[model samples]
Target: MDIAATVIAIEFRLPGPININTAPAERLQELPGIGPALAARIVAFREEHGPFDTIEDLTHVPGIGPRTLDAVRDLITVVDER
Candidate 1:
């Protein structure tokens, strides 16, 4: 067996209580159904529009819908402005 073939892939998990309005694309990718492109779109949408008021507001983002919202709802939150 080749030594290189023995390499193992490791998965890195992000710490939870992730703030969707403020998390970087990388961290956002850890959500249930979100990937790199969707994560970037979320950030772009947030920047172009504004912060999300409620988790359901995520459906306003182009690719996200009610299903995706339901999947990630528990994993994300909008940080309140104080």
Candidate 2:
């Protein structure tokens, strides 16, 4: 059925991509799993650390994980030079 097909399409499609390295807390919440607490933590970590080295490095921050990183991997990038 058309409805079933639509659901299938949605299920097969990938979630939105997020940029973790520089996204603001509000923006971070747009991702799949992040909430205000995590978003605030991310901002604080960014402020304290200056900038992130890599997407994987987000896990090293106070409140992130592999799943969280996976959600925003495409959208986040380290813009500044090390």
**Using lDDT as the measure, which candidate wins?**
1
Cα lDDT tens digits for candidate 1, 2-77: 5554443221233456798999999999888899999999999999999998888899998999899988888888
Each model's lDDT: 0.85, 0.74
Model 1 is weakest, by summed lDDT over 10 consecutive residues, at: 6-15
Q: What TM-scores do the predictions have? A: 0.76, 0.63
| Model 2 CA deviation exceeding 4 Å by range | 1-21, 80-82
lDDT of 1 at 7: 40
How well does candidate 1 score on lDDT at residue 75? Answer: 81
Residues 1-82 of candidate 2 have per-residue lDDT tens digits of: 6999988888667544445666788988886677899889888987888777777888877667777777767766665432
Candidate 2 positional error at 73, Å: 1.8
